[model samples]
Target: MSKIVARGAGVVSGMIGGAIAGAVFKQVWKLVAGTDEAPQATSDEYGWGEVLVAAAVQGAIFGVVKAALDRSTSRSVHRAIGG
Candidate 1:
């Protein structure tokens, strides 16, 4: 039962985490690039360096956010399960 609860929580938390990460990345990109939109890899307007940098930053933000959310959810589930 605890395992099932954890799995369901993981799925829901992951979706929420992704949304949070994307919003965070957008704000960070705006600060770094002074623009509201990040560059697409196929966009000709942005150079390879710019596109790669954006991708790297976005990836880092998503990774961190996911890890944080996963840990938080795990801890909450553990406590609720009386562990």
Candidate 2:
């Protein structure tokens, strides 16, 4: 029962973290690229450097957010379960 609840909480945390990461990525992209729209890797308008950097930043933000949320959820679950 506790494990099930933890799993559900982890899912919820991931969803929320993803949404937050999207917003953060957009803001970062605008600042880094000086554009509101992010560039696609295959797009000709941007060079490979720009596209790769954007991808790396976005991925890093998402990974960080997910990790933080997962950690917090795990701690909460541990406390709730008195473990």
Candidate 3:
């Protein structure tokens, strides 16, 4: 049960992080392009296809980061335990 909860929390954290990173990227791109206007969001502009692609990419990145953090924590705990 604890493992499941931890996994869920990790996923939620990843999603939030991804969204924030995406927003930052969008803003930076706009700034670099010298566009003062906000981009328009049309129903067909960003459909499920774009969303899924972005999610997949972000998910992979998040997964790798989470795995690395978990491994580092495990190693630290092991060292503290003199193992």
Each prediction's number of clashing residue pairs: 0, 0, 0
lDDT of 1 at 77: 97
Candidate 3 residue-wise lDDT, 16-73, digit = tens:
6666656655565456545543333344555676556545654565566556655655
List the candidate 3 regions with Cα displacement exceeding 4 Å. Answer: 1-44
In candidate 2, which residue pairs get closer than 3 Å at backbone N, Cα or C atoms, i.e. clash? none
Give the lDDT ranking, best first: 1, 2, 3
lDDT of 2: 0.92
- Which candidate has the highest TM-score of all? 1
User: Which regions of candidate 2 are displaced past 4 Å?
Assistant: none
Q: List the residue pairs that clash in candidate 1.
A: none
lDDT string, candidate 2, 1-83, tens digits: 99899999999999999999999999988887789988799899989988888889999999999999999999999998966
Q: Which of the numbered candidates is closest to the native, going by highest lDDT? A: 1
lDDT, candidates in the order shown: 0.97, 0.92, 0.56
Which window of 10 residues has the lowest lDDT sum in candidate 1? 74-83
Estimate the TM-score for candidate 3.
0.47
